[model samples]
Every structure is written in C-alpha cells, then in structure tokens.
Target: MRSRRGALSEVYDLLRSEIIAGVFDPGAQLVELVLAEKYGTSRTPIREALRRLEQDGLVERGERGLRVRTRSPEEILEIYEVRIYLEAMAASTAAQRRSDFDLIRIRRAQETMDDTSTDDPAAMAAANRAVHETIWAASHNGTVVDLLTRLNNHLTRYPATTLKTPGRWPEALQEHWAMIDAIEQRDSARAHDLARDHMTKARELRLELYRADPSA
Candidate 1:
C-alpha cells in the first residue's frame, strides 16, 4: 500500500516522463478523471501531479483545465538563450575552480555519453544531462546549479526526439569533450565560449526542427 505522498510522487513522475517523451502531445488536455483512470489512481493524486507539473512549466492551467504547455519557435529560442548564459557561466567557473576529481567525474560522464547508441533518445538525454550536471557540480556554484535545474525542468517540455537527428549526437559529444578539455586546462575563456557555442548550435537544431514541422 502506497502512502498518499508516495502515490502523488509516482503520479508526478509518470506524467512528467510522458510529457518529456512526447507521449502526451503538446497542448493536449490532461483531464484529471481520465488521467486517474489511466494510472489506476484516484483524482486526488492526478490533481496533485498536475499542480506540480504546472509549477515545473510542463503543464499549464487553462480555462479548459490542465493542458500540456506548447512552445512556439520564438519561445524555444528564448529558452535556449537563457540556457546558453547559464551553461557558459557554469563552464567558465568550473574551468577555474575544478579539482582533479571533478575532471575525472566529468570525463567519465562524457565517456558514458559517447558509448550510448543513437537509437535511444531517452538514454541520450539522460547521459547528456548527467554530463551537464557533473560540469555544474564541478563549478562549486550552488546558485548556478539551482538555476540550471529550473531551466532543465522547463526544457523537459520539449520533445526528446529533437536530440536524435542525424550527426547531432556525435557533434554534441565532441562539444562536451572540448568543454572538458578546456576545463582541464583551466582555460576559462575557452570553456565559456565553447559552452555558449554548444547551446547556440543546439538551439539552431531545435529551431530547424520547428521550422520543418510547425505542427510539432
């Protein structure tokens, strides 16, 4: 038997995963009764989950009730712009402050990402996130990590498949390695520039996808 908080947490996690995976299409209605039935939970947990999703920016409270948040091309670009600033700051700080152990952890995360096959978007996303988090932790900056975590919550609303395009994964891995190399060398300027460029390129890819499929 699950406790009330446990059930609500489970509901939140499941709904968030579905939203990130594009299982629930953008702007789709998330009716409490229907979600309750689908998850074999009551409306209580479903409502709790939707409220939490709203806070995470994965869902919005509309006149019709709860609906998945939809992003326009412009909005997506804006989000990336914020990410670029935050990630670059983290990279720069990490370069100047990272310990040998921090570098080792970052290298391990990158190697894990490199070993991941391109066939699995979820695995790729998870690996990518791990590498980023490791970099953030190496920075020794709590505020930067908190900001990036919030930004990531919003980013989860976007389709994970956006990272699955041809040649993108290898390019991303290379970029991560370059940032790590800069950090290991204590080249703050290079690390900052590379991190910013990496995010800019990713934003361009996302924009291209949006242009190709306006409905997506």
Candidate 2:
C-alpha cells in the first residue's frame, strides 16, 4: 500500500495535471468524495491534495465549496503584464549565467518543440513550455522561477492554446530560435529584447482571443 505521504503526493500530481489539462474546467466544483472515488484513493489523500491545491491557487473556496479558479479578463491581462518583464529578465540572466549544460538542456527542449506537430496544439504547447522552463532554470534564479511557475499555472487554466492561433506556430518557433541564439552568444541585451518581444506578441494574441470569446 502506498504510504500516506506518497498517496498525498500522487493524488496532488494527478489533480494538478488534470486541472491544468482542462480536465477540470475553471469554476468546476471539486468534491472530495468524488475525487477520492475517481482516483481510487481514500478521502484522506484527496482532502490533503485539495488543501495543497488551494495553497497553489489552482483551486479556491467558492460560495459553496472548492472550485477551480476562474480569472477575469483583467486578471489575465495583469498576469501577462507581470510575466512579460519576468520573462525578459529570465532570458537576460540566463544569457549571463547559463553553463554549457544549461545550453544543452535548452537546445534539447527547442529540438523537442520543433519535433512536435503543429496539429497537436497540446503537444506543441507543452513543448513550448519546456523551452521556457529550461530558460528559467538557466537563469539560476529560484525566485523568478517560482513566480513564473505560479503565473503560468494560472494562465494554463484556460483551455485554448495561443499556439493554435493562425500562423502563430511558425512565428513562435522563429522567436524561440532567435532567443536561443542570443542566449548562446551571451548577448544579454539582445536576449532581453527578444524575450520581451516574444511575450508581447503572446499577450496580444491572448487579448485578441479573449476579445473574440470572453468565455474562452
């Protein structure tokens, strides 16, 4: 039998992934008993997982009970605004601080992204996330990574991928390549500019999408 702590961790991972993958939509009610039965665990683990998720901001207390977080359009825009600067700083710092091993990891992530099919939006989005994650790691700044990770979780609660926007996949790939090149050259200023531009474009696309469908 899984230990209690192990069961808690397992349940937490499963729930968090499901929440991020849109298996649990924003504002969807999260019932302890229902989740316990679904994951074949006791309510004890499910309860603990819910508590951790609440702390992570993935779930929140609603009028009645716990439900997935639903961000307003203003909130979404605010997150992007903060993310833009943080991303730029991460790229700049990475260019200055990254080791050869960090470069290899970044290149691997970029290659994985290139290999992902554009038709598979989820895969493409996941790959894109991997590239950014590596860059965050290369920055060697735990605080930036933690802040960005939380902000990203909030963004991913939305179901649609910005990569699915017409003509965006190729554009994003080019931007990633350029940013990688700048980082490789240790050109911190260039990396900052490229990363800022990249995130600005994403913010624009997200705004357009939200304007087109507020519910999305």
Candidate 3:
C-alpha cells in the first residue's frame, strides 16, 4: 500500500543513486515522458523526482529540459591533487603542533563517523568534514584551513563523498585510525605519508569511476 508520496520518494532515491553512480551519464536528458514510463508513474511524480535531483545539483534544466550535470573529471583530479598536498602538510603540522585536547576532538569526530551508517551520505559527509576540519585546526593554520574549506565546497559538484563507495568505508576507517595513531605518536613523516596515501587511493578509485562513464 504505497502512497503517491512514497512512490515519488522511491523514484527520487532511485534516480539519485543511478545518477551518482553514473548510470544516467553526464548531460543525459531526463525526459518526463520516458521517466514516467520507466517508473510506471504519472508525469507528476516524475516531475517531482526530477525537481529533487535538480535541487541536489545532479541535474540542470536548459533549453533541452533536464539533463544530468556535466562533471569535469580533469577538474576533479586537479582539485584532489591539490587537496593531497594540503592534507599531507596539514597532517604533518598537526602531528607537530596538536595538544592532547586537539587529538581528543579528532578522535571524537572519527568515532561519530564510525557510529553512522555508510548508507547515509549526508551524515558521513558531515562527519568526514568535521574530522578533517579538526585536523586542520590542530595544524594551527588559518590560511590553510580557509583554503581547504573552499576547495571542499567545489568538490560537491562531483558525486557525494567517496566514503560511501563500496568497500571504501572500512578501508577509509582503518586509514583514519592509523593516521590518528601517527599523529598521536608525533610522527610527522608517518602522518604525512598516510594522509597522502589515503588521498591517492581515493583519487585512483574516483578516476576509474569517471573513466567508466564518459558521457560528458
């Protein structure tokens, strides 16, 4: 006994997941008539679902109506590489400059993240941001923190955080644990290396995803 609202919600989730996974491909038009047929619904629900996607930044309306937004893989890579260097420096500085209280805050952030389900992207993204921001604070560099925050916002143009990718959560969690240990031990080099490796691995996985779906 699914209500119309329930069906519309389901359709929205289905379309959102597909779009993020690149199933719809960038710039692919989402025609109301085609979607209505595909989801076995009226144009009303289809429109509702599309409006949600548009609001989410997963779609855009032009002269041709709604199309999946084009994601520039090159820009994604460039942004990531920049983050890698900044994160490596931040982690190293954090290891050198952090107090016990700073470390405790970072530990708390990761614990919160671990307690949340990976299926919830918003929660994971929020936790992830908190954890990183804490580390940046520990670095005691306002300039770097401000720059990284801006860079992170640009990343939303891509799919959500890589934390929710299949099999990535556990690996990422372990990496975070190791990073915490390195920073706690005041091993600046180790912390820097771990941070770089973590970002590098994520970059590789994300590039593969972009390569597989060459619609844009």
Candidate 4:
C-alpha cells in the first residue's frame, strides 16, 4: 500500500538504522541484492539507500561495491578532538542565549538519559545521542547543528560498547548533569569547559578500551 517514494524512504531509514546500531559491522560488504531481499524491496531502493548512506559517510564504495566504514583509534581520537571544539562552542552559545523553554527541554533530555544504566550498547548509544542532540538544539545555530549531525554519524562507527562498562554510565550521567547546570545558570565559560572536559573524558575512556581489546 506504499508509494514507490515511500518504499525508498523506508529502505533508506532501515539501512541507516542498521548501520548506526552496528548491525552492519565495519568493512562488511553491502550487497544490494542481499539488502534488497532483506528489506523486501527492489534493488532500486537498495541502491538509493546505499547512495544516501555514502553521502552521510556511513558507507563507502570499494572494489566490492559498498561497505561500512571502519574506525581506527587514530580516527576516533581525531573525531573526539573535533567534537570537543564543536560541542564546547555549541554549549557556550546555548548558555548565552538559552530561554527557559530551551533549558526545560534540555533538563528533560537529561532526566531521560539519567536512568540509562544498562549494559546494552544500543540503548546507551541512543540515550547518549539524545542528550547531545538536545544540547545542540539549544544552541539555535543551524550550521553547528548540521556539523554535529555529520560528526555523530561518523562517531556511530566506533564501538559503543565502551559506554556499557559498569561505571561509565554513571560518570556520563553526572557529566550531563553538570552541562545542564552550567547552561541553566547561563555560565558560558563553565558550560564550554564542561563540554570539552566531558568529550575529552569519553575519548580517554574509548582509547583505554581500545588498547585493552585484543581485536582493536
């Protein structure tokens, strides 16, 4: 009962979600025929979906056609560095210009993410993304929001299992609270410092986990 356009859109969303949740592992080839069968759609929609993912940096074309991009330790570090600067800028701007409504929305996101104490990588990743998106939305900067969206897409390639570690969830929740408090108080400097520190800590944690992993 769906139009061709709607079918294509659904295929795209399905593929995007699978890639983001690590269902498609790094370097795994995306065979159009396989995906088309899996999604119960035609190859045309599958190709369109892959093309969209390529534009989002989630997939790349190789001699084998499309494959999920891999994340190296160095690349993860670079991403964190960029995120630190951009997130800090967003937090600082949000602190300076946030209205009561914005603060309330941020606080709600913080509350929603507060109870994210689970070993489920997918759930934690979703909650973490919600927190960041809420904070970025408070900034009211279109360009920064667009940049963060791209950065987040790249970051989804990283092994999010790091956040599922025993104590990391609590630490991350506390950091989110600190950021919320800074924004609520209109403390631009504090918000910027906190945002940078939060991302730096996450980078350190991920690096340590990567070092400990034999497969990394």
Candidate 5:
C-alpha cells in the first residue's frame, strides 16, 4: 500500500506539472490507457492520481472521461477580480514588512524574469510566478499566500504567458520595476496601486486571448 501510494503521488505530480506547463493543453482528454502506457503504470495508480487532481480542481469529468478543466472568460475575469485586490493587498503588506532578505529575493526574481532570452513561455511564466511568490512570502500573511497559491494553480491552465502577449512584456517589466521601487522605498500605497494596475492590464490581455478563442 505504501509503495502504491508513493507511485500514485509521483504520477500526480508529474501529470500536474505537464498540465500546468501546457504539455496537456486545456480541455485535453486525460485518457487513462494512454496515460498509463506513457507513465509505465497501470490504470489503478493513474486513476487514483486523477481523482486527487479532480479534488484539487485541476481536472473534471467530461463526456467520455476525465479532462482538464476549461475556464470561460467570465470565470477568468472573476478570478482576476479577486486576485487584483488580494495581490495588491499582499504587495502593500510586503512593502511595509519586507526585510532585506525579502527585498533580495524579489530583486533576484525580477532579474530572472528580465534576463530570460528564450521565447519559451514556460520558463518566463515560471520566473514570473517566482516574482509574485517572493512578494507573497514577504507579505508575512500565511492565509493570503495560501489563497493566492491555490488560485494560481487554476491559472496555470493558461497555455501561454501573459508576458508573451505582443507589446505587453516590455511594459510589464517596466511596471515591475516601478512596483519594486515602491516596495524598496517602503511606499505601501504606491506598491498597492502599481500591483493593481499590473493585474488590471493582465486581466485585459487574458480576456482578449479568451475572446479570440473561447474554446482555447
């Protein structure tokens, strides 16, 4: 039972990573037999892992079988509505409470995002996540961090990075610099406002993308 449980967990993490990375695109079927062969496991463990994923709200039941959940534009907008306020509040807290180490980590993550040369959305997206995670860590509010992290898991279903949207990253990077400056200056209001603007732009871009292809 222990060994089986371990295998189940391993499968769960692997599949979750791929799903988040867009390896399995949104709305893609998670065919058990296919996944079983790919993972070199039987259906039992795959099924168990998928069950856990459903509980995590990463996947849902489809007509034929299990598939990745697809979010409508309105659902996504609702998510960002909550995220904008929560994230901005977190940024405010982080500015007020951040230590030197917190500042260092945030700077490193910002640098990481700015330094990415490859057009690989996954790498940029991961780096972008690091910056926000650093801020959340600095916030010192475990409840907010936990809530944002869970919301983020649902957001990872996006097949592309908002940073990669044409004419977005450069402006977004500039916004990050401003936000960082506000944090470093311990200007909580500025940090909050900048964070809110950043999310509002992101919400617009994501809405455009969804409108372009609602099924995507």
Candidate 6:
C-alpha cells in the first residue's frame, strides 16, 4: 500500500501537472470529493493535495471552494516584475559559479531553441524554458532556484507565449546568445545586466500581446 505521504505527493504532482497543462480550466472548481474519486484515493489525500496546491499558488479560494487560479493582465505583469529580479540574480550567480559542464548544458538548450520552428510557438517556448532552467541550475543557489521555480509555475498558468510576438523571437535568441557568452566569460555584472534587460523586454512584449488579445 502507498504510504499516506506518498499518496499525498502523488496527487499533488498530478494535480499541479494538470493545472499546468490546462487540463483544468482557469477558475474551474476543485472539489476534494471529486478529485478523490478521479484519482482513486481517499478524501484525506485529495484534501492534502489541494492544500499544497493552494500554498503553491496554483489554486485559490473561490466563492464556493478552491479553484484554479487565474491572473488578470496586471497580475501577469506583476509576476514578470518579480521574475525580472530573480532571473537577473540567477544569471549573475551562474556566471560566477558555472562549470564548463554547465556551459555545455546551456549551449545544448540554446541549440534546441535554435532548431525549434518559429511556426510552432509552443515548442519555442518549451525550448526557451529549457535554457532558463539550465541557467538556474548553474546558479547552484538552492533558495533562488526554488523561488524561481515556483514563480515560473505561476507564469506558465497563463496561455500563450510572448515569444509569439512579432519580431520578438530573433531578438530573444540574440539575447540568449549574449547571456551565454557573458556567463562563459564569468562576467557576473554583465550577465546580470543582460538578464535584467532581456526579461524587461519580454515583459514589455507580454503586455503588448495581452493588449492585442485580452483573452490570452
């Protein structure tokens, strides 16, 4: 039999993944009884999982109960604002601490981005995430990585990628290349500035995309 804690963790991961994948629409009610039935578990584990998801900011209290969290355009911008600082810090630390192997992993992620078709924005976005995740790992700061990972979860809850913005892809690719170069040279200050500027541009484009399509 699965341990109680194991069951809770399993349900939490599945629920989080479903939220991230849009299996649960934004604002969809998450009932403990329904979820317990769906996952073939007791309400105890489902309740615990929902609580964990709430703490993760993936779910929130609604009029009736908990539901998947949805952000307004302004809320999304605020998320990017927080991301900007965290990403800069990660870049600076990564530059100072990254080993050659880390550079290799970063380069590999960049190569994946390069190979991704612009016509498929979702693939491009996933590739972009790969590069950023590698940089975070290179930073080797567990606290920063944990915080950024959580922030990233919130960001991904929204549909559409800013890379889909016209003329944004090429510029973002250039910025990623520049960041790689700075990290390779161990230029922490320059890496910090580049990462900050890169995210600032992304945030601007995100606002533009939102304005163009409010549903996004």
For each candidate in turn, the TM-score is 0.90, 0.91, 0.66, 0.88, 0.86, 0.90
All candidates: CA RMSD (Å) = 2.0, 1.9, 7.6, 2.2, 2.6, 1.9
Question: How much lDDT does candidate 1 score?
Answer: 0.90
Q: Can you write out model 2's per-residue Cα lDDT over 98-216, one digit (the tens) per residue? A: 99999999999999999999878789989999999999999999999999998887787776788999999989999999999999999999999999999999998888888887656
Query: Scored by CA lDDT, what does every candidate get?
Result: 0.90, 0.92, 0.84, 0.85, 0.88, 0.91
**Candidate 1 vs candidate 6, lDDT winner:** 6
Leading candidate by lDDT: 2
What clash pairs does model 6 have? none
Model 6 agreement with the true structure over 83-129: per-residue lDDT tens digits: 99999999999999999999999999999998999998779989999
Off by over 4 Å in 3: 1-70, 213-216
Residue 62, model 3, lDDT: 71
- Model 3, span 1-216: residue lDDT tens: 889899899899888777766788778999999988988888988899998777666788877889987777786788888999999889999999999999999999999988987778878877878888999999999988977876674465566567767889889889998999999999999999999998899788777766775431
TM-score of 6: 0.90
**For model 5, how does the per-residue alpha-carbon lDDT over 46-91 read when each residue is reduced to its tens digit?**
9998998887778999997899887788778888999999999999
- After superposition, the stretches of candidate 2 with alpha carbons farther than 4 Å from their true spots are none
Clashes of each: 0, 0, 0, 0, 0, 0
Model 5 error, position 182 (Å): 1.6
lDDT of 4 by residue, 149-187 (tens): 998888766655567766878888888899989999999
Question: How far does residue 165 in candidate 3 sit from its true spot (Å)?
Answer: 2.2
Candidate 6, position 121, lDDT: 72
Clashing pairs in 5: none
- Which ranking of candidates, highest lDDT first? 2, 6, 1, 5, 4, 3
Q: In model 5, what lDDT does residue 58 have?
A: 86
lDDT (10s digit) by residue, model 1, range 1-216: 999999999999999999987888888999999999999999999998998889888898778888998879887878888899999999999999999999999999999999987878889988999999999999999999988998888877665455687888888988999999999999999999999999888888888888888654
Shift of residue 38 alpha carbon in model 1, Å: 2.6
